[model samples]
Each structure stands twice: as C-alpha cells, then as structure tokens.
Target chain A: MRITIKDIAKRTGVSHSTVSRALGGNTLISEATTDCIRKVAQEMGYQPSAAARSLKTNQTKVIGVIVNSIDDPFFSEILFGIEDAAQQAGYSLFIAASQYDLIREQNIVQTMMEQRTDGVIICSSSFSADKGRQLLANGFPVVVVNYKANENFNYSIYHDDVDGSQQLTRHLLALGHKKIAYLGNSKSGRTSLDRLNGFKKEMRKAGVKINPAYIFEVEGSEPELGKDGLHYFMNLPDRPTAIMCFNDMLAIGFLHACQQACIRVPEDLSVTGFDNITLSAYTSPPLSTLDQPKYSIGNEAAQLLLELLGNKIENSNNTHKEKVLKGSLLVRNSTSAPLQNE
Target chain B: MRITIKDIAKRTGVSHSTVSRALGGNTLISEATTDCIRKVAQEMGYQPSAAARSLKTNQTKVIGVIVNSIDDPFFSEILFGIEDAAQQAGYSLFIAASQYDLIREQNIVQTMMEQRTDGVIICSSSFSADKGRQLLANGFPVVVVNYKANENFNYSIYHDDVDGSQQLTRHLLALGHKKIAYLGNSKSGRTSLDRLNGFKKEMRKAGVKINPAYIFEVEGSEPELGKDGLHYFMNLPDRPTAIMCFNDMLAIGFLHACQQACIRVPEDLSVTGFDNITLSAYTSPPLSTLDQPKYSIGNEAAQLLLELLGNKIENSNNTHKEKVLKGSLLVRNSTSAPLQNE
Candidate 1:
C-alpha cells in the first residue's frame, strides 16, 4: 500500500529517474515539473525515507548539540543562533541537555554516534579533551563550545572569559570601588574559573590584596543563591562597596536581595554581572554586565561544523580549526561610583 | 574494516541471534552477557546503525519537538520538563524552533516524518488543526501543547489559560486597582487571545466596562516592546493605576520602564505578569504572576505520546485522550493597593 517513486512516475507519465531527481531537489528537472511531482507525491503520501537514503550516503545531515541546561537563557540564545545558521546550512539538529552530568553527556554522545549524525557541537557539557580526541580518532567531526581551549581537540569555539571578567573588574575599579566582593558560581566548569582568574588579575594589577573572605562561590546559577550571598555579605563587619558576580543571573539574585535588605544598588553596593542575557537588560536598574556573543558563538559553531563536514561556503576562511570570540562590556544602571561612607 | 553482527558473535563466542538479542536489549539475554557484548562492541568501534535496524523496526526511538523560540524562558522550562521525562523513557529528542513561521513548521514536520520519528510534540508553532489532522491521518502521532482544543485531533494538552488569567485579574482587582491597563503581546496565536479574553471576562464579572483604549496589544514577546508600551501609557492623560502584562517578560519590561521613569512599583504602577518563569521571581519586587505547570505539561505530553505509541508503563491510564493542566496565581511583592491619586 506504500507509494513509491515509480508509482509517482507512472502517475505523472514521466521516467522514474525524472521523478527521483525532482524529489531529490535536482535542479536539472524543470520547476514546473518538480512542483507537479511534489504535489502528487504529497497527495500520495510518499515520504522520502531518510533511513534508506542514509544507507547510500552514510550521512544524516543532522548535527547533535549538547548543552548544560536548555532552560538557562544563556544556552537558549546560543541555540537560537545555532538554529538560524543550521537552517541556512541545510542541517537539522538533535539537541539535548546534559544537566552537567558526565554520564548523561556520554550517553548522549553515544546516541548521536549511533544515529550517525554528521557532526556534533557540545556547549558547556563537561566532556574532556581526551574524550573529544577519542571521538575525533573514531572519525567524528566534533566541536567543543563555550569551554576552555584544549589543544587535543581539532575543533572548538569559546569566549574570552578572562578578558571579559577583567573588563568587568576594572569597570568596578574605575567607579572607585576598593572593597569589592565576588559572588561566584564554581560549579559551571572552567568558564567560571577563567572569569574568577580575570577578576583576580585586575584586582592584583590595582595593588588590592585579594580577600579570601570576600569571595563567595555558590552551588547554582539562580538568583536565590545570589540573594543568600547578599545576606551573608551584609552581616560581615566591613561589607563590600561593590560585588562582581560569576554571571548576570547571580548578579540579579544579589540585586533581588538588595531590594529585600533595603540596600540600593550602586549606592550601597555596586554590582556587575557576566554574560549580558536578554533578561539582564530588563532587570531593575538594567544590569551592567559583560556582553557575551552568545548568538554569534552558536552561529559560528554551526558554520565551523559544516565546514568541517567539507561543505563549501562562499568566501569563508574555513582554514581555522577553532574560533575564539570576545565578550565586551555593557555599562548599564546596575554599577556606579561607590558611596563615600562605604 | 566495518564490523557486523557476525563478527561480534564470533568474538563473543556467542550465536548471532544471542548477539542480536543482547544488542537489541532483549531480556532473553542475561545482563552479564549483554554487558560483555556491549564492552566488546565498544572496543571494536562497532556502531549499531539506526538505518539498518530501523529497516527492520520502523521506529527511530526519537521524538521531534518544535517550539516558537527556545530563547523564550517559558519554552525552555517546558523543554526542561520534557527532557527529564524523555530521558527516563529512554527516548532521545530532536528539538528545533518553528519561530511561528508556518512554512518552517511544515518543513520541520516533513523532516521529522522523513526521519521516522516515533512522535512529535509542538509548543506554540503555527501548525493548524487541518495540517495536524492530515499528519494524524497519515498515521503520525502528534501532541499539541499550550494550544486550543480542536475536536479534529485526539491528542492535545493545554494550560487552563482562561482560568489562570482570570485568577491574575482577580488578584489585581482585590488589591484595589480599578483602572488597570493591559500590556499584552497578541501575536502569539491562541494563548494570547485566551489570556486577553480572561482579563476581560474577570473585569466584566466585576461589573466594569472594558475600555478599548487600555488594551494595548504589542508586536513580539520581547521586553523592548513592553517598555515601549509603558512609555505610551505613562504619557496618557489619565493613565491606569495598575498594569497587567501578557506574561512575566512583559511585566519585567514594564518594571524596567518604571525604574527608568522613576515610577516605583506598587506605590505607583502596580503590575502583574503570567507564566511565572524563573526569572520573574528574581525581578525587583518579585513579580506577582500566574504559575503554569510548564514541566508537567511536557512530562504529560511525552507520557501521552508513549501511551499512544503503545509503550506500556506501570499503572498509567492510556484511555485519556487529552490532559489540561491548570495555572495558579502567585501573589508576590509586585502588586498592592493603588495610590490615592488621579
């Protein structure tokens, strides 16, 4: 009862090869004839089986993307950019979240391999350089995204976290904030670590001895932890004049705590966040943070993936195995000069 | 150097059928044997090809999900819920964005069909009932989420949006706000219309005449539009004392606009949002909004799809054709009695 290309050829009074070519999007067939064949095929319920075609080409034209959490606004925007680029490049995506679990990450990779996806891009999943090398050795085109650069992997794309955090720290210093605190989230792998290093480097350059008591690393990225950090910091003998958070989400949490504790931002304690998410712009006082090229990172990741798969792009320099994008500073209402008393 | 099941069997010193059963995850093969065979297969770089196996059993063991935007925080939470359930059910996901474009939606559906996905769950894409009917008629299982109920399709799951919005409206009314303007984003198909209608219905029940001037339907769901809406309303001759937004994102935008205008929340422009996204809770004043069961909707959708696909579970009611989850109002710091002024 299944309809086939031959049946369509018989119905259209065309050769089987012509029907096949039209269905396969061959430009050799006239547009009018292709349209007619497509209409007939749709009416007849002829689904061009990817499974059968994949057997011949050994390519699914599908890419797999694994992220820390899809719900995190940061990953979502990157995915947005990735999708836009993937659609144009004629590849569908198999997206999953690892939730920062290594076992789940491995299972997802194995599944993508078994499905024989053309390539994969991992964004913030904790798959190591060694494992990435193994996949590459097994002839898989892989790209590690939003992670520290590992020399073992042939392909990767990440942000300049060190520069970004340093810029944020100096921004606070320029505002005359000497007694600044850091609200950190160490759980998100090396990106946070890099951000912390940048913060420390800028502080050291200004001849400020790093205060161990001022650095607070929390468990999660939500505002609740930030709020909790605020309570702990406020109870200290000498509260910080400003706070630099791991990211905007944590900063927003601290801002929320300020509202609860009757402490005004920038006046009582200036705050700066990393990764200027869309929501960060709408937060009360419109968060001052580091503007990560989230969408571009995703877009370039997909572009790099296609180039790795030997897809020729017009006027693109695909010679580079890895692309490093930079994050800029977005000065908004959340940061300002420290109060005289503070 | 491609290895086959025969090669695997020879190495494992097991019959080809036993190797097949073990690889297939059949219970007939003992766990120890299956583990040994899997370890050997992994060592040999053996990939059980989905294409070859799908030819025997025409299922992909994958689900395709198309949403309006993953960057939208609400959709991400729903997806969070879906991934949790899907992972437990042992099905991987192929997620993409339709971006509310009908052609793209159809193309995605066609792509999913060609890939032989076991089922699809759509979150606010522009796939109409007729197209859904056509897909169902062609024997594809589809679940429509946060969409209106259509009799033509036996599968659908939606939030009780009217009830939820009415609750929000009533909450605003109880807080002593009589003149309230709605900052709505109307482009989002049925969900938006249903929300607007719920707002009106509650006002009508309270014996208040609906003012057409106060109902401002914005373009997109972003905060910028909401901010623009706030500017227009603030400049009005007799601005409403309270504002109800289409969702929390709009409410946050309005909150931002208020901060820029020196308009204090609750004390000046009391505001409310819907769909209690996680970011909403962190916004200044902890936005009062309606809580939609985003995760549950996704979990139930997958559960229903599995049920429809005849995948059995312990103590599940597969007879239910549809599930409608309800949203509840969460009273927070965003709303209060209106200031006694014009």
Candidate 2:
C-alpha cells in the first residue's frame, strides 16, 4: 500500500531525488519534468491518504452553492432538489450566503477557487455575469439561477417570468379586473423585473391600463413588507380591485395586512402572488400564484454542473446550456371576480 | 522538501528499512522501535506531501452536520447559526439529511469517519445516544443537539423544551382559559413528550382539567396536518376553546383550517405554537410561540464541537457537558382569551 519515490523513479527512469522534487512542484524542477512525474504518479493509481486527498485529485467532487439566505423556504426547497441530484452524482454540497452582497459573493467565489471546487451553482442578483465570465475563462464552470447569464459565458437557468406573470395577469383580467396592481420586492432584481414585464404584456393585450397609483414596491425580504405595501394601495380612494404580487412571501404578508384591516380577500379585494412557495397553499383562502418548481430548478442546476464537471458539456456546440423552465399558474381562492361596487 | 525515510532512520540511529516498517505500523517491528521512530518523525517536523499528507495528520478540520431535513426552514435557520460559528472557527460545513432515519444517520457517520472529519454535530431524533456513545468511545467527538444524551457519554445540547412549553401554556392559562388542547407531532419523540409533560404540569397548576377528547397527536412533519387535526377538534360537542400546538408548522396549518372554516383566530379559538420559526409571525393572526433560538442552538452545538475537536473539553473533571438553554415567550396575535359564546 505504500508508494515510494523509488517506485516512480524506476518507472520514469529518473533519479529518485529528481522524482521527489518534480512531484513536490519544486521550482528548481522543470515544468515538463513535474508534469510528467505527476501524470505518472496519477496513472500508477497512487491513492493519497485521506488528509492528502486535497492535493492528489484537486477534485474534491464537491459543489459550492451560493444563495441569498437559507432561512427562506424558497432556497431550502431548491437545496432539497440540488441534494437529490448531487447525491445521485456522488457529490457533496457546501453552501455559503452572500446575503445579496456582491463583495461577499466574490469572496466566496474566490474561496471556492482556492479550495479547488469543481463548480458552483449560484442564485444571486448581485453576482454579475461578467464575474461569472471571468470564472468561466479560468476553466471553472458556473451556473447562475433565477437570473440569466450572458450567452457568452453560458450555464444559466431561470423561469420564463414574463410568461408566468402574463398568465397570472390574464387570469385576473379574464375575471373583469382592469385596475390590477403589482406588488413587487423593494430591491427589484432580474426575476422581479421579468415578472413585471410579463404582467404588463398581458395587461396591454387585454387593453387594461397599468395603474401607477396602485403599484407598491418596497424593500425587505420579510412578508411584512407586503402588509406595509397594502397601505399605499388601500389609500388610493379608487384602489385597484385586484393586486398581483412579486412572490408568495409578499402575498402572504398582504393577506395578513388585510386580515388586520378587517378586509375580506377576493370579496373586498382580489390578490395573486408568484412563486408558489410551500406556505402559500396553507395561507388563508389559499394563495393564487405561479408554481415555480424550485426543486426542479435546483436539480437542473446540479445536473448542469455535473455535466460541466464531467467534461460532457465542454467544447460542445452548445457552448452554454441555458434553460428557462416554464411555471404553471396555480389558481386558488385568493382570486375571484371583482365586486360590483369596485 | 522531500521527507525521506532515511532522514528519520538517521535521527533514530536505525536502518531506513526499519524506520519505514515502523511508520507503517508493521506488527513485526518492536513496539519500542516504532514508538522511537514516530516520536523522531514528529520532532523532525516531517510534513507529508499531498498523497502522503493523509498518513501524517488525522485532523481534517471539517465538521459533519447530520440533520433530519434541510427542506424545513427550521433546520435551515439552525444551519445558519452553525455556519456562523463554523466560519469564524475556519471550518467548512457539509450537511446530510437522514430524513429522520437512524440507519441512514449511522451510515453517514461512518462515511464521515472514512473522510476523517474532526467531529460531528447531530440533530436527529432517530439518532440514538447509545450510538453516539460508541462513537465517543472510538475517540470521535459527537455533539447531539435538541436531544439529550446520557451523562455517561457527554457533549449534548438541547432547548429546555419542557420549560419553553410550560411558559407558553401558562400564558394561555393566565388569559383565563381552562380547556386548552395540545397538538403534538405524530412521532412524539422525546422533545414532544417533554413538551407534553410541561403543558400538563402548567394545566395541573392552574387546576384545569385535562380533556382526552381535545388532545391530537399524530405522526408526520407536514404543516398541512394542522388542518387535518382541526377537523377532529371542531367535531367535538365540547371542544377545547384554545389550542397549543407542537410547533410553528402545525400551528400555521391549524390557523389555515380556521380561516377556511370561518373561525377567526383568537376571536373564535386562541392558538399557540412552539419553536417560533420565521414564518410564525407571517401567519394570519401571527402565532404566539415559544421563541426557540434555533440559531443559537446551532451556534452552541458547533462551538461545543470546536472545543471538543481542539481538545479543550478533554480530561476535565466534567467529562459530560450537557446544556439546556432557556427560551423566551413571544406573544403574537394567535392567542387571546377564549370567547364567552364558545
């Protein structure tokens, strides 16, 4: 089980001392000699002990995941999906949170590089595609989710936010709502913007004007923001009869706010949310939202990274495997026909 | 620099072959000879190369975290805490879900051993203290969280579930409620039993009678189970006026059932929950829960493991370090005095 320097020396016809220096990456040794010695060591199936595994394969077979926060059930659902795929691929996952900080994201990425991670799957609005491109340029494969990466640096996955929102908007419009409102995240990111575009497209097609007075966009990841947003919409003497929210977190908050205000849902005001996170269906009146399969999104991201790590996607005509999975509209009790008075 | 066996051999005044055999733990070598060679090897600052680094150091500085399910936001919140401490300690965390299965936990523990992890922090109900003791016997440090291990083993941390539950129950009792119901997880693990005992103790102190008809204990981790449990309660001719649930997940579910059934929370029947998970506040009526600081529990567990891994907790008068941290009561909107009509 023990491999001696003499073993490599005899195999490569080099002095034992020279083999030792070359294998150690000693600067005094020529690069060609070192590479040759290392390659032979690898070919001879010399398994480094557990502690040395870091140096031997330089392939930890580990995937680094960057998310905004794990406390959000949305990210956890995605992680469950990632775990399924990663477990099947015999890879382990290590996670870090950027908390939407670009510098933190960059630092984590640098650390991942230092640890020689095979690849990373990031769901970040702050992480620039240009940064991803730099990683790709350095022979690292990166997958960005919930946001599209530039085609030049490819491996991106996201929902067709426009389509999902359009479907949701049309659902409300079909029920005879013209003054529909859009409640979005305070810090609007790619998905929020995409969903907004989708909502506008449907509203335009139906000839229903966008009510700027009814729009409520606020900062904060808390569902409480949705409750805070309600004050703006309700204060409008001619408040929109229906509201569409950026995600379920805000929608749940909106519902709580209405409950506090003693306004009945659908009867007094109709509301809809996107990204049917787990707690959505359990909410009172059950939430009407778009079902973005977070699990599938995670699974797909892991699958892509595995393919990239296995060199299956490298040098292919499909330079970057970009995916935008479609989400289905889940209509629940939260939406209904506008009241006659409205 | 190359660390040749000859270097150690010269230092020990032994043949190079003998030094190599001794380092290999060759049974044929005398114990004294092997001990001398090892001590010299240690003193000479012999550093092993990547392939050989594995043989020299058993310390990988990695912490293996065994969780039941990362999909649950509760666990994720705990993980956030663990990550906080682990990152400060310069260790990386890799998590695995046993899905509440004991066999899988053991398998993961074995795998972690093969990987040579410095220590393991487990938060699985299915994992046994006996198993933990076995690992401890083997010189592996194991920190059990949210579950108590026999003092015979040492290194355990838990939330004072009984204390937290008693406080919440007392809050409901002080509000002039005599017929309060308890909804526990179907699994009814040790934590559930402790919480149940606490609820009973508080009720007994208030001189309130127990109603067998109102106790709902069923198995499962689903939040939707709250809705299903509500059906049983509402059907009773003499139903309890208030409900204290196992955790935030089930409490959220119960609140949804009330919303759908046209029973306004706190107005019709007060409700309370354990483990004030993040979404507890977002729920309609905002659950009045026992604020279990999940993050702190995770932090403390990681800190304990770090201490154990650093040999800071070894060879002390206190072989066993058992911690049961205190939790506070959070009065949210979910609970109120029972209605006179009901």
Candidate 3:
C-alpha cells in the first residue's frame, strides 16, 4: 500500500494535518519537528502524489513539447536545451511527435490539456496556430519555435534564415562565382522561400542574372535529395559553378555524390550548406555553412513559456512577442572562387 | 473557469450524476441522454482532468522514458519507435535524459514515481538497476534497454554487440587483412568491452596473432576520437592495414583524417565500424558497419512494459527476462585487401 500523510502521522503520534504541514516545510512548523517528520516519511518510503497536489493547486509542473520528428537532429538538439531548462525549473516534459499530421497534432494538444500540462512548446514548424486555438482560448500558455502558421502565436522563437542565406550567398559572390544556383527543399514551407529570397537579394546586389534552370527546389532536404540535385545540376547544358544547399544534410549528400563521381569540391564545383550541424564540421574538406543556434532557440522558447506561466492573464490580449536569433557564416574548404575560364 | 461535468449538467438540464455517468460511458445511462450530455460537454469545451480520473482509477496512462541523451541520433531513432507504440496505446511519454549522471537518473526516476507514471523504460545504459530498487520494491513496471549494470532487470531489450563486432572482424579477415586493430570507446562500459572481446575472439579463431599495441580504447566514440585514433595508428612503427571502430561516428572521423592526410581508402587502408547510423551511408567511400535494429528494440521494450503493466503481480520473482536482438553487416566501399607490397 502507498504511504500517506495519515500513515506517517499515525507512526509519529501526531495529527495528519501536522504531518502535512511538516512535510510541506510550512514556516509555522518547528524545524526540529519538520526534520523528524521528514525522516520518518523517508524511512517509510513516502511518495508524494503530483495528481493530488495538482488537483488543489492547479499546477502540474509539467511542460508539453510537440516536435515534427524526434529523429531529426535539428529538433533533437532543441529538445535537449528545453529539457535542460525545464529540468532545472522542476518541470517534467511530455514529449510527442506530430509526424507532420494535422489531426495527430490536435490530438497531442488535447492529451496534454487532459493531463493538465502547465504550458506547451510547439517545436514543429508545420503545426498550425489554428490547431492551438483551443489552448489559447482557454488561457493556456503556448510558445512556438520556428512556427510556419499564418496565425501569430503569443510567444515564438526562430532563427533568421534569410540573413543566414544572404551571408552564404555573399561569401560565394565575393569568391567571383557568377554561375551560382540555389537548391531548395519543397517541404520546408516558408523557410525555403525565405532562404531563396536571401540568395536572390545578394545575387541581385552582385549584378548576376541567375539562369532560370539553375534554381531547383526539390521535394525533401535529406542527403538523398541533395544527391539528386547534384545529378540534375551536373546534367544541365550550362551547369552552375557553385550550388547553395537548403541545409547541411543536403550539402553532405552533394559532397558524397561529388566524391563518388571524382569531382573535387571548390575545384570542379563549389558547394555550401545552412544549419552547421555537428556532422557538417566533420565532413571531408569540411562544409562552409550557416550556423543556427538551435540549442539557444529552444532555451529561449522554454524561458518565454516559463515567463508566461508565471504571469497568467485571464484575458487574452493577443499581443504576440517573438525573438529572432541571427546565424553566422562559417567559411570552410567547401567554397572557393570558380575557375578562371568560367 | 474550467468547464466541468457540473457545468455540462447545468447547460443540458440534467443532474451532475447523470452527466458524469454519460461522460464515463456507463451503460446505465440512456444512449440519447449520454449523446446529448457529451455534445453539450464538447460545445462547452469541457476538459476532463486526468488528475481527477487517475485519483479514482490509479492509472495515469503515462509512460516514463529515460535516455542518456536526446541529441544522439541512435537514441532519437529509438525514441521515435517508443513514441509510435505508446501513442497507439493512448499513452503519453515523459522523457528525461540522465546524460550519464547517476544522481540525475535517480532524481528522474523519483520524479516519475511522484508523477505516478504507470511504468518506466530506462534507455540509459549507465542507469544502474540498484537505483531502480525503489520502483521495483513498490511493484512499478520497469524496462531497461542496453542496461550496463551487473544486476539483471525483470525486463530488458538490447542489441547483440558482440556478434556484430565478430561479423565486422570476420569481414575484414576475409579480405586477407591480418594486421587489424580495434578502436574502442572507454566510456561505453560493457558495450565497448563486448565489441573489443568480439574482435579478439574472431582474430583468435582466424589463427591471427594479436598485437596488444594495436588495440586502443579511448575515452569517447565521436568522430574527433576517430580522427585521434587515425593519427595514433599512423605514427606507429608497425601500422595495421585495417582498423575496426567501436561505432560509425568514429569511423567517419577516421575517414575525414585519412582524406586530410592524402591516404587513399580501400587501396592503402581498410576500416570498419559498428552501428550503421544514417550518416554512415553518406560518408566518403561510404562505411562498412553493423546495423543495430534500434527502432525494433525500442518498440519491443515498450511492448514488454505494456505487458508487465497488464499483469501486476504482488510477489517479486527476481527471475529477470532479457531480449537480445542481432545486428547485420553492411559492406560498403570502406574495406579491401592490403596493398601488394605490404
């Protein structure tokens, strides 16, 4: 049988209320008595019930975190940061993956609500803000990370992809690469568009007219897609001198293809990637990419949620707050000036 | 205010008890009344509190999963599998990372207990079975994966690392590479030892004389460590023709080092790795490694936990059960016979 306050009180020859106060560390109870009662409780293996306490206090001390996919290295690093912050603040995380399914996202939110999570952090970019309306309408604290929804969330944290893309493009342009192409991921929603825009803005500034056939937006952003992009670009009648990838995974794939085909990177064709993941640094010749502070993004999102939890307002003001972090350019061996004849 | 059964009853013009019965799907309530009450509850946004329900049923419908780290690709894949199975059973997961900290693992288990998690799946290999004594003593269902502790757990699921290492060693031997070395991670506890032992066992079976200096066990298993191993081996007076790594990450690092040093793979040296991670397939020259069924291991662990939860036995049997899964060898371009001169 589970040990309760009454059992402890009975063992200590005191009332249940006294045992509760002592265990609660109430100032009214003497330190000596509290210590004695805590010792007895520990000896008896007393386990406090969060459900019972949450019923009275209306605080579960739990945070709900929804991600697109757990296996994605990007989201996993973010989750690591969130877990660190939440654990420090005495909060447990209820982690779920939506797998890009709308109904699954909604059901995850409903389950979190039923479990009485104190707040929620949506790390899934594809999660629509409209699906979170139920939580927002009920005054639950919700924070989003790199949200792609049309509707604005009360709190959000995201990396500045456009600026990062501009930095990469600027690096390539400075290396005298006029024949540069952009490889995008169709599944990345607004992120792909923002990155492409940044590339265009820099190329326009450099007085370079991008060839229509040079721009290729593929279905996915994995290494396989990057490999496919490599094949498509190499097969073109007028191949690009340099290619900017959607992310590091794509860049890695492109590099692998080049290695297999005996085409030297930065010698035959220059390549660059975004989101300087751990593997990016270890790739052969290393990759010149944009570094996103994924951990900090997650940390900031959790900090914002904790702030919202502290100041609960019954009225929904709908005045949203957002924090955008910048990504820095990391120049490495993957990029260089094009051939003199090109 | 949070909507309750009382509000549903008031809105539907029925007694609170009738509303409760209807929401509970009790057959005693008429179908028409139940449907009407449920519809009214839905319209009112009635959120059923898990705390209230769990207090009566003593089941939280929550599973606690403890991992070594969330950012690791291997563990992330396992977590994905666990999430799929648990979600199908209408269970939410409380994920905590011990990060190889013993105290943190204890605290995580304690937090899960306080939260009244129905069962826990310990994925951290470093998590000691002794620390889980409290949960076991209280009859809480516990499952461990790749557990390192000497004490056995009632339920466990792990990969057959020993067999995997032997397969890799045998592959290299079949390529006529007698001068082989083993690079291991010192921090991997039993896993590292098992892989190294397997390498030794295979070398002995092949009637190959072992070089004690060729076996180097480092403190980590990252790509950087592999790079260090490459340098260490290259500087040796009698360099081994082939090196077997503890895992793919190390092999990736070793490959990167070989590229920088202008050493040709499959022509001058051969290398093999265990645990065929996603990046292994894209690495330069690709990687020959062992593929652990990471997802299935997680799925099986969750299934076993669910079964244990269903059968709640009072007496502790202490007759532990273990499930070991085999790993398959994947031959890529990373390995070949030694040079003719050598």
Q: What's candidate 2's DockQ score?
A: 0.29
lDDT of 1 by residue, B63-182 (tens): 888788777889888887777778788888888687777777777877887888878787764556665665666667778888674555567788988898889889888887888888
Model 3, A67-94: lDDT tens per residue? 9887677888898788778888888888
Question: Which lDDT value does model 3 have at A36?
Answer: 90
Model 2 regions lying over 4 Å from their true place: A1-51, A128-134, A186-188, A312-318, B1-57, B101-107, B128-138, B150-153, B312-318
Ranked by DockQ, top first: 3, 1, 2
Which regions of candidate 1 deviate over 4 angstroms?
Answer: A9-22, A25-45, A125-134, A311-320, B10-18, B25-39, B42-45, B125-134, B311-320
- Name the lDDT of candidate 2: 0.79
TM-score of chain A of each: 0.89, 0.81, 0.94
Q: Lowest summed-lDDT stretch of 10 residues in model 1 chain A?
A: A311-320
User: Which pairs of residues collide in model 2?
Assistant: A51-B54, A52-B54, A186-A218, A186-A219, B186-B218, B186-B219
RMSD of 2: 11.0
> What is candidate 2's lDDT per residue for B107-215, written digit by digit as tens?
6665565456668888876566666665555556778888644454577888999899899989988988888998888574887888888999988888888998878
lDDT of 3 by residue, B1-342 (tens): 798888888899999999989988999999999999989898888889999889878999999898877767788888877877888888888888888788788888789889999998988876766767777776678888887563656688888888889999999999999899999888888988899988989989999988988999878777888778988899999989999998888888988889889889878899898878898999878998899999999999898888777767622555567799998999999999899788
* Candidate that beats the other on DockQ, 2 or 3, i.e. the better one: 3
